[model samples]
Target: QLRETLGIELPTNDAPPTSLETATPTQPVVPQSDHQCQSNQDQSPEPLDTSERQNSDLRAQSTEPLHTSEPQNSDLRAQSSEIIPVSSKEFMSVSSLIRGRVKLEDVNKTYQMIWTRFKEEGKTDPLTPGDMYKMGLKVTGQTGEAKLKVLRALKIVHISNKGAVKLL
Candidate 1:
């Protein structure tokens, strides 16, 4: 009579969920209101408090701005900015027999530097040892003259080996 009057069922931990009148196997009711949400939010705080403290410490330690152009500019450009860009077809056209242990990256860098200089200097002639030597010398930590000298020596070696060569 009391259960019929109140119209509420007591919760039993031992009862299977399937036996509950208010809960179906597929859907269980959840009661969430604005106050409940706010209470839950107040109970659990954000984890960023430690990070904020560290940031304050970092700010106190230095007067310089975190994002300074001076610091950003510290990074340097690549060494091979003076070489001309040469296609595989162009390279092969020069000589298939000119094979070396030279790296493709190094060759590409050299080509880029040459192309840049040629474009800027308004020179259209084939890439010269002097030209590459100048750029390579700067990047390879050798003198321009020395670079030219080494290239000349390599040329002699290539010719002696009977390799078809195109000099650019």
Candidate 2:
């Protein structure tokens, strides 16, 4: 019944053992001297035709310099302004403080605190919603959604439907 269900036929007790089943374990082969190892190394297989083509492609790519333009002054300024530097501790505290009662004045103060912390840390990148969540900020659920809406209304932060947070 089990063999039928599994779609496999098991050998009966009366069946003779196969060569594989009768085989004995053997010791692994190891080179006894460096001469044998050197001979083995000398017999290295030639590179495949596909590998040669890939190598040529890589060489061509390496010869071409990557183009990267400098960020515009306005773009730099906008990016710098958008990045709010709040520590994980401050973020958690502020999130908890504004949980049930979200006041604009309190939110503004919290933003200032975060900005100060960010400056102290010297991080210039904008904090994403994933980063905030990692720092213990719950940006899901009913309360989390409400808090995000309040923060957005006050122009403190913008939370995208796709879970991205941009601090303004």
Candidate 3:
């Protein structure tokens, strides 16, 4: 009676109402332009094997070793080998100073002396704290164990649990 009054079509008793959950288009959707639809249909996608072959060809082309002259390589080697001198004062200043009457200059000097001695002797093994203390005392004359603490705090040297002291 309402459909008739409003002049709107209503589902008849013979057909059920179209539900949103079941509603789906039967045909495959295509672009609106006829030319685009024709072009898309004409060209099929390339096979996986053919695309893989193209990728392998590209890989083969890129696999060749890069060429470099001997002089350029030698220049690089020389640059890497060249030692850059660092100032002891600057090095000391960069490290955190351990307070308690141990002078930074003495520590630096002691470290230099020990390093020079190590180099002179061509010593590969780690030095004992006693060896370092003797070497440090001879140079700096800052007696006792406080010098070792300063070395440790500044990270200039590392003392192992076994009392082996090694320069960092």
Candidate 4:
């Protein structure tokens, strides 16, 4: 039991998504000015896929209540009615961090925190496959094309991927 609880190492794999750069066609006429032409950078995150929907829903549900910044040691800590597993709890923390609910300068900081937690628990890696997408969707809601644009802004989704839909 002790081995199962404390000795087992959790495996996590970190795969950074490939970023696509879009090129805008140059206009035949150049405006005479002191300013130089600049290429637009895509700032949106990745769009949610079928493979990520359920996990995204689950992550969003779990994180909905934990956004409060109440002190951990306070007696008024909120109690959840659901019985959550350790893995699920960890998922929430990591997902929340990814979604920027922790309010860090960058998502990488949250990634480091998640990595450190898993490492401390004798695990080399931590994030589950779908958890990454869930975190992405939470960071950018499925509200609409504009919402997807927000996802693209974060560079979280692959735009040319088959699962991505064309938005107006």
Which model, 3 or 4, shows the larger TM-score?
A: 3
Global lDDT of each model? Answer: 0.43, 0.56, 0.56, 0.38
TM-score of each: 0.25, 0.31, 0.36, 0.17
User: How many pairs of residues in model 1 come into backbone collision?
Assistant: 12
Clashes of 3: 0
lDDT of 2 by residue, 80-161 (tens): 7454433333334444445565444444454554454455565656666666567566556665555565555444565666
Q: What is the C-alpha RMSD of each candidate to the true structure, in Å?
A: 18.4, 15.7, 17.1, 30.2
Candidate 1 lDDT over residue span 1-168, tens digit each: 766899988675986554356677788666555576565647776576888989988888766645545422112222333433434543333332333334335554543465465556766555544444555524223433232233333331121122222233
Q: Kindly give the number of clashing pairs for every candidate.
A: 12, 1, 0, 16
What shift in Å separates residue 33 of candidate 3 from its native position after superposition? Answer: 85
Cα lDDT over the full model 4: 0.38
Candidate 4, residues 1-168, lDDT tens digits: the string is 665989887766566542222223552444556345544453456798987988989988966765557543112211432222122233334433334433332333333333343434444433442443554423233322232333233432223343342211
Error of 2 at 135 (Å): 0.7
> Number of the top candidate by TM-score?
3
Candidate 3 lowest-lDDT run of ten: 77-86
Candidate 3, 128-149: lDDT as tens digits: 7567666645422333345655
RMSD of 1: 18.4
